[model samples]
Target: MASDDEDECGYFYDDEDADEDGVAAFEDDAAPPPERRADYTGFRGGGIGAGIAADRLCGLRIFVCTPNPSSFQIRKGGRCYAGSAAITQESLYTAQKQDLSTVMNLLNIKQHQARALLIHHRWKIDGICDCFDRKGRERMLRDAGIVLQENNSLASGGSRIPVGSAKCNVCFEELPLNSVSTMDCGHCFCNDCWTEHFNTSVKSGKKQIQCMEVKCPAICDEGTVRCLLFGKYPEMAKRFDRFLLESYLEDNDSVKWCPSAPHCGRAIRVGAGERYCEVECPCGFSFCFNCAAQAHSPCPCIIWDKWNAKNTDSENIKWILNNTKSCPKCFKPIEKDGGCNLVRCKCGQYLCYLCGGPTGQEHTWSSIAGHSCNRFKEETAGKSLDTKRQQLQRYTHYCDRFKIHGGSYKVEMEKMGPAVAQRVRLLESDLNLPFAMRDGDWLTRAHRRLLVSRQVLSRSYAFAFYMFGGELRTRPADQATLGVAKNLFEDQQERLEHHVEHLSKVLNAGAPAVHQVENLSKVPVAHVPAMPEAEVVRMKQETVTLAKTVETLCGEMYKCIQDELLPLLVEPMSIAAYRPDGPDKAKELAA
Candidate 1:
């Protein structure tokens, strides 16, 4: 802990041991925003300032009116620090060992037994504890296919094995004691049979290989499995080892493999009860820990899934299915223009519009020649077309806005990000300016605000599509309540959108040009131009103010989402809570 005097003096130093609550030091390259503490006040209705709680503040170095602060307080937000850790390939064994150790020490059980318990409980320590409390130790262990022995020798199958000779239950052949092994369940099987069974299980992608004896509920010892297989099949033994190691990620609820393509070979583990939060891996890939999708907050996974599917190929297929009939001869989609049972395809094939079958060119209103169809089918098709058209229109409206903001976000991230960084370098490199005036944290914070706010604005459209749309099965009685909620949501969303654009404009308009030292070689040093001090001050203040405002507006939008809108749904769904710093970065666990 830092002394009070040190904190008051703004004594900043780089410390790898720094925690989420510790003051963060920035670097030249793009990095995850450091964790900060913020206090949440209950949602209050008023102007933007009234709703601006500490919880909504970004994790940037917030310099309100000056670069230096006399004193400050850090308050933790509920969603800011999700206590997640990044597990890389290097640290995978260490992490798995830690979890195994916890269970082993807690229950005084062997490593394999602990592993069985953890895998069965999905690697949730609290769940194991809860089951232990509810079912007691004996029953819980039994249920997880763990049979505890009084001593190591008993558990090792030494007592049950005969000194002379034993028959292998699997092969039904007489085998020497040296050639056979007994499992913890007292089921003895020949090495050949055991190896083949393990080989089959491993080839079939079974992680937990159980005893070969029928009706035996015990998990085979991992060490024994390895010993039996390593001599004949070294690669399969290695694979078996890999499976047990990877089980920490595959079986655990809180941990997930980073969803990066070309596989980052890293998994993230979040704190208990925080699987719903978003996290960033050390590999620079950010994702929602809950759904393993791109870091999309304010948009629930279900809505995002629906939106993605709708945008890609589903809508096009739907439009064809709903509005067009396939030509019977060419099998191409053909639209009906007007007043005809017989429709001509561009492929020179004639088809019945109502029945979508081949027909002669001559046709009456009631029937096409050689193609009689149900007249009532026209009513059903008409009604279906109307419904599909309305759905397509609504989807297009929301999707356009979603894509627009998303496109803007890409531009800002790729283009604006470099511009901001260059300006920061230009400002900080100026030896003529005062140290306090040269700090570019305000600009960085504002730009981050723009990027995050744009994301919120974009995803909110997806949320609105599902929330008030027909995807949710709402009752007629709830219609009035939903209307009021929709209006409120749209109001907040509109406010956020306005400020986000304003911030973007401010950032783009104010992006400083890098004063190149190389260009100065051609010109006299005295002729060099400099930005006025007053303008710099004004730019700082304006950017900071807008960043704070956008931060607050984002909070209110999320508040509206959680408090006003989501509860009205028939089926329960939840979104990851908004974090002003974006997703929490998963700390790399040491090997």
Candidate 2:
């Protein structure tokens, strides 16, 4: 409900001096204008020439930094604003201190009051400040059920105690002053009754316990709640503390826990406007931040969801429809890949593929002798099988390509990745090879590009399938324009697919062999072999060139989708921008 400016202010600015509009006022009259700050550079330098070789080979820049970097910091308006820190049960207090310190410093309020405001506003400093600006200090405090009492002595467990006994409100019994606890709102109640209320609230998962007095809009003091509950209900006290600590994640919109299986116990926090982006968690799981699903882009979440559901059943149906025929003896489906129409099933029944009728064992490739069911079947008036057939064919065309490229990506990642590493080690150890040629990281980079582009190629088919097929097809007037756009998109997709495949092939090509010396008995003699430096150089160049080409094609395909094909749709859809180095790796959180 708060405006963007208010949200930005909350994350970045300290509200020490501010105007009526909630903007922070500069303390100095004459101050230099703020300079543009660089965005978070998570990847840094490679070892000198290796970096240059990588860039030249891939036709893309690669950053290599020493000591590594922390998770990419989310920057806002040229200043770093949001980022996630891993929080353990022991570090919860430390993780929460920064936000608490900011609110306390800006509002000049006590820790408990700051926490109350944060909880009420969902821990959004911007929303709190905006409310403070719009409603003034007193009204904002009142809305969050906080009452700033002047007489500190009247607060619960204060040093001062009443001289006489007091009447307990709930039980209507007179109790000694020390037996009753007074809340911040000056409402007094017997300790036993207070404990019961606090325990019930805590059990019900209520983070903010209100004062028991009717019409009193004050929250119970956390210290009082802890002190009272810790004595009798230590576990409940622990639960209450945990609830308060986790409110930082539960209440804040910008942060989310890594949705990894077995629990990664880490959260990712993005900038205010970055909810729709893809982020990789330190646990090596990359996901769409908005949907928390596997990183699927170039296909909107809605389309991806539908595609997944359809594929689950569609594959089986497709196999049945295209590849199988019912066996005459058992009425069971049997698939014939390529031998003959007269197929024998496990039940020892010979079946005709054309008609699913019983056939004799004596048959040739051309004919099941004397048995024929090739006569044209009459078509029904209302049922057009051709239209249904065409639809299935269309879906198969796209799905086949999608599965092929997707399957290839998995193979390359599993098989080629380690092989490339082994080849790089061999090249580095070869004494005849130049020192500059030893760094074969470019091969790894190219292989990564191949994998990434293949993914794009795979998902693009899904996008095309929905964009140009089915209910989303354009109207008649737009058909010609749609044809043009479709051609352009397909062209890009084809080009990207070709280059990605080429890169895969180049990276998969085995490394040059190094010869090992053989020892023959008595007098020792060593034979040295010359390295195939020229072949190595040529392979390196080819790998780099293919990688660059794949990267470029991927970029072009993404551009066509975003700028050309997507605009044709009535509804808005977006995909994450293509990253040349694969999805950005999340840095580990500092201790």
TM-score of each: 0.65, 0.63
lDDT score for candidate 1 against the true structure: 0.67
Candidate 1 local lDDT, 307-340, one digit each (tens): 7787687756565446445788877777654212
Clash count of each predicted structure: 3, 4
Tell me the whole-model lDDT of each prediction, alpha carbons only: 0.67, 0.61
Error of 2 at 24 (Å): 30
The 10-residue segment of model 2 with minimum total lDDT is 36-45
* lDDT score at residue 5, model 2, on the 0-100 scale: 25
Which residue runs does candidate 1 get wrong by more than 4 Å? 1-82, 85-91, 151-205, 212-214, 313-396, 513-531, 587-591
Tell me the RMSD of model 1 versus the true structure: 20.0
- The residue-by-residue lDDT of candidate 2 on 1-591, one tens digit each, is 134223323322221111111111122322222220111111111133233223222222122222212111211223232433444544555455555655544444445677898888876655665576578666787778777643232432333333367677887778986577665566778878888889999999988888887877677767667767876897897798778878878887656777889778877655434556677777788877777778777777767776777778865466645644568788788765421234688999887654567877765323445553322123421255577665665666567666656867776666556556666766777777788877778877887787778778778877877888746744556677787887787767755655565566566554322122111222132222323899888888888887888888888877887787776677777777777865555555443
